[model samples]
Target: MSRTIMLIPIGSGVGVTSVSLGMVRAMERHGVVVNFFKPIAQPKSGDTGPERSTTIIRNATNILPPEPFTMQYAENLISSNQTSDLLEEVVARFKTGTSEADVVVVEGLVPTIKHPFANELNYQIAKAIGAEMVFVTHPSNDSSQQLKERIEIAVSAFGGHKNTRIIGCIINKVGAPLDDQDRTRPDLTEMFEMPSSKTNTNLEVLQMFGKSPLRILGCIPWNPSLVAPRARDLAEHLDAIIINKGDMDTRRLQSVTFCARSIPNMVEHFKPGSMLVTSGDRSDVIVSACLASMNGVKIGCLLLTGNYRPEPQVMRLCERAMETTGLPIMMISTNTWQTSVRLQSFNMEIPTDDAERIELVQDYVAGHVDKHWIETLTQGSTLPRKLSPPAFRYHLTELARAVNRRIVLPEGDEPRTVKAASLCVQRGIATPILLGNPDKIQLVAEQQGVKLTEGVVIIDPVTVREKYVAPMVELRKGKGLTEVVAREQLQDNVVLGTMMLAQDEVDGLVSGAVHTTANTIRPPLQLIKTAPGANLVSSIFFMLLPDQVLVYGDCAINPDPNAEQLADIAIQSADSAAAFGIEPKVAMISYSTGSSGSGSDVEKVREATKIAQERRPDLIIDGPLQYDAAIMENVAKSKAPDSPVAGKATVFIFPDLNTGNTTYKAVQRSAELISIGPMLQGMRKPVNDLSRGALVDDIVYTIALTAIQASQQQ
Candidate 1:
């Protein structure tokens, strides 16, 4: 079960999105897999895209959050007195997106004239999802006592703080302490619309909440950079025409300057990232800007007024400077004063493509948030650590990054393989060596919009096949001593890659995106062989059920094992589960529960359980249990009351491949869950096989698993 944290705004424009994003990053820094969710979309005025919070999260991180329901949908439900249905929908979407996360951060809807029931909806949704609340508010002209009363009222509406659902509060956009001059003039405010002078200071706010049950998470100070818009945004807002569109998308305007003075005086305001607004006839100002650009000053852009374009001669004279500096230049019909007025009321919504600013805001807000509180939330957690699918995948990526091994991909020319290889290299999961024709692989990457960076190594099989032929001949000389057969076998990329792994040239191998499973696993069995265990190779798939991740063993290998081989498979599966961070609660599956029924299969399972228990008593191993009794608590209590591993089994060992494979496919397809592998265990070297219908993400995670396996062998 995922823990939920809801951020509710005390008033409009409280920066709830930023607060939610900050909390997520802070939790991630502590190594928790966090998911961001917004139940309803609240599009601001003139905004036609997706909700800002979801967009920012998707662009900034690897997590792909679910799209929010539109406001119209919620409105219709509320109008028809179907609010219960609305909350049911919210809960369904929430569970769908967050079932695989350790923690989920939900951003509540902001109260506006268009939606008066937002606050009530927020409360109802939080209750429906069982989310703890974190009230987000800014100190805007409210005294200490006034702020305390406001929060008290909100808490009472939320069933009071006695329930402890209201965990804490964040004071965002805290203004700087007022100086004597500012204190004397109560109406004075900063240029960037900082908190008013009447608002209480940080100390006053904290002291006010000292006696309250809610914790004061942090007081985030006002940051003007977070509210600044890019030059491209300004251009779109003013409907300006481009004169020299350079760095418009990336250059952010930190401040606006009106060049009303002469060249000597106006040049003093030429700061980097400052937008200069002046009449188009000011050739002197244009010449000064060109000179500043030549001297390494990167002003955001030059905004011309009154539909003016610079004289052709002046632009021609500064052509070299413009070309060298790539200064962003644009013109608008509005005069200087009009433009300034529009700038004062500009929209400050963060765009989806402004990745640099999004990262800046995430880091900035996370830095100001309470680190000790975050540590307590993550380190001192008392919730059950049920491994979800997202959490498992996140764990794989982090583990693979720590190891940083090289993995060989045999089907590099395949489109999905090429994209997955590029992603792995870019994300530092592994250094994947793609074995194919370099030109063909490059063409595939270009077609897929994947940038093959320097980290993605492309090795042509034709050049490397000859080198491996002699080594393969020596390794398999006992089978038949012939160079011709070795060369012929080396033509297959899977065989070549397996030989590489056998020779210790690469850390691991992942293939079968385009090849058959036999083609992938045969070479490894022929060359690398099994580990120094007294048994055959077996396979397991990490079945990602809705609530937790379960392990199903012998699903892809080993048909009809006897008592001894079944016991060995159980032991190997348990070891693999433990290695990958899953608690090893072994359940030997059969058609019976305990001694209820007798058959050859049930007897085999019973004997296998006893042998496994004798071999490793530390593991929780029980046998001859039905699938429902092994997994469901009620069934376990009724059918196998005294069995230790009757319920809550994380690893299931089948008596034969026929049962295992059919059961795994049934559950996987019926539930539409993600199944990670058929990861081969008991291999001397780390060699894994993939499915022919694998997606890019499936391939990437398999590579990560292979890397972790290689590291474990070391």
Candidate 2:
């Protein structure tokens, strides 16, 4: 849809900068090409040259237009008494630059009591520009209805056109110290207003509404970087310890560039609020400096200006610095001059002053104002709005909403496994058919403190022996096993349960909780084999953390796979990511990016990368890459500038099982990140293997993932 959406701030009280930035950022997140426009900007007197807001938008977007394309002084376009000239200039900018843009986000003037011109100007701009009106208000208990009334009156006074859609209202900065706030004030919705709000604590409101009808385009948190006086001033305000004893504090720390010669000094001086300046290839130095400075002060971050790394002696010095300081260094991969230039134009203090006010305005606009009733009045049509389910709904409420799908959990000596399965069923996430003695399963659940409610379907292996015998006999026919022996093996029920998945009696199977990986996968492999076109079976650990989801491959299977097998692991991990709704950008992780390192291990990854590309011609695959190069954009750009899968890689394919397992665990332990799965893939159906020491949440997510996988197949 080619549409321009402009956000106009009426006056100075509301947080116009923050709201404008947030809308732009949110649009970017939605993969929409949007442009920011400010028709009339009045910066404080001391501010030099152009408006600070213009610079902020330009910095955030990294797009500097030439001459008329950029915003000029309001007087240049509009005459002294004619406010309409300002609106005309804004519309012209939108028409000129927004040819290919999906939306044009124009920040409006703040709403003021005395300056009726601001509101009048906004209404005229909306009408003249053929734009929809979206009012950004602060969060107040009764503000939703009041704002709606005020907007209706303003639009009416300005001669509202039939083409103009009062899209809705956005509430900013909710959740203050008021504990007894009435969020569900019925008057707001009854007043026929479209509402959406952004909270101060979580910036995910945009993410949430993006998935629903409310259409919360973006929720920008108050970024500390937006403040002014550079990093040094912020350090003083926050009482940050300065590591660089030699660098002058008054040197306008706006753009703290990391210098190679001063890296050791930079590492020591790495404070949270400052920017890092260093050489590009000196990632080792940069990483070490960050590690060292991680102890006391927050390193404002790194800015790698030069395209070079530190020498070995400097690297050694950085390592020592890391041992001394213990802080994380931030590194920017841009060239030194470019980094400095970008930093210089940006005024940091623009964000600090009115971030809270912007948030409050957004919350107020987004407050629970009804859109359905408003649509009837505005468009003469009745539309129903979908309200999100309340948080902490009862288990029955969720269960009633779920599709009926049957899953089987094979019984074993480890009753904890069965208990975990039973708990998943109770939680309404899965319907598990436990393959073991019902009495024994109950006993295990009791011992483990897991409630085995009526939801679980238990099938005793003794009673179901005959049902699995024929399948076991068929599976073991070529292995020189007699019917009796096959029957006994099938009595294990893990084998029988796997047979059910193979036979399509159940949608999916979950085992390996009590059994070893070998035993658990052996039966499935023998009977099910690889899926069509899948050459080899592999496993992946869905290493999920609070902030990110990473895939580590060959962690549970293939003790020490060769190059070809490692390649297979990469392809399988990529497939797993695709199955789980993530675009798989596979990186064959090693100790090197390209030819930076020597040794058979590096060669193995290089060969695996080639093999993986040959196998999955459509996938973006790169190899012999260090961990940082695979995930960090600056490192990726610096190390492998031409490589497609370097910095933006999502799936990490390890060279061997040892590195795969060890690296993920080390990251988990050292970083205090959560790791789920060692999830098995490449089977015919969705049968997953769990860790012998799996937690309840682990079992729950695994079951959910398995169900999702099975649903896709269906």
Cα lDDT tens digits for candidate 1, 330-436: 99998877877777556776788787778667767876788787666655554555665545675788799999999999888888898899889867999999999
For model 2, residues 1-714, the per-residue Cα lDDT tens digits are 455455654234335566666665444333345566665665543365566566665643433422232223544444467656666766776677665555666666555553335666666677776776666644333344443454455445545434346565454443321122432121101122223342232333333343322233333333222332434433443333333322223222323434555455544444434455556576665665456354333344444444354456655656655445433232334566565454433333343334333333323232233323222222321222111111011121233226456778885335556656666665566777888777777665653335667888788778777877777677668887677887777866778888788788887777766677777788888877777877777888766543246678877778788898888888888977776545788989998889888899899889989988998899999888899998899998899998898887879988777888898889878966556676676777877887777755566666666776676667
Evaluate model 1: give its lDDT. Answer: 0.83
TM-score for every candidate vs. truth?
0.59, 0.47
**Candidate 2 versus the native: TM-score?**
0.47
**Which runs in model 1 stand beyond 4 Å of their true positions?**
1-106, 111-375
Best by lDDT: 1
Off-target runs (Cα >4 Å) in candidate 2 are: 1-404, 412-428, 442-455, 712-714
Best by TM-score: 1
